[model samples]
Target: MLLTVKIGKKTEKLKLNRKEKILKILKKLGLNRENVVCKLNGKIVTEEEYVGTKDKLEIIIIVSGD
Candidate 1:
């Protein structure tokens, strides 16, 4: 399955397995899984959220102020 990622102002396309999670995709993309957060369809998501082609995913990377 392919998931679309909206990080900041850039949108990137990712191809992953249907069972893959946002964290896996993030890691594949060289994103720090500990620092990045994910949201799917405008809702906050956990690491267990299933990634499917039917889902239009939104991934957000959280930055620490300190």
Candidate 2:
């Protein structure tokens, strides 16, 4: 399954063999789950959310300020 991922300003096309957790997907992309938010098909989803092929995933980086 091929998943389309958009992180910040970059877009990536990932090939996945099966459904997996959002956290694992983040790790595959060398991303920290704690520092980003996952959105599936325009809907906010948790790290535990299962994603598969033909899914549109958006990774939003969390920013902090003093």
Candidate 3:
């Protein structure tokens, strides 16, 4: 299965198995799941959400400032 992930100005295509969760994919990509907000098909989703084969994912890295 192919999952499309967009992070800021960059976009990535990732290969995931059936029933794969968002958190696992992030780990594979070397991203910190705790610091990123995930959206699936335009809706905000948790890391435990299951990803479909053709799901489009958007990853937003949260930035904090003083």
Strongest candidate by lDDT: 2
What TM-score against the true fold does each predicted structure earn? 0.77, 0.90, 0.86
lDDT of candidate 3 over 1-66, digit per residue (tens): 677789866998887668688898889889998799999999999999988777888989998767
C-alpha RMSD values across all candidates: 1.8, 1.1, 1.3
For candidate 1, give the lDDT: 0.74
Residue 22 CA displacement from its true place in model 3, Å: 0.2
lDDT (Cα, tens digit) per residue for candidate 2, span 1-66: 688899999999988989988999899999998899999999999999998887889999998767
Superposition error at 4 for model 3 (Å): 1.1
Off by over 4 Å in 3: none
The alpha-carbon root-mean-square deviation between model 1 and the true structure, to one decimal in Å, is: 1.8
Of the two candidates 2 and 3, the one with more favorable lDDT, higher being better, is: 2
How many Å off is the CA of 6 in candidate 1? 0.9
Q: What lDDT tens digits, residue by residue, belong to model 1 across residues 1-66?
A: 566778867898888665677777777878876776778887888856777776766766786798
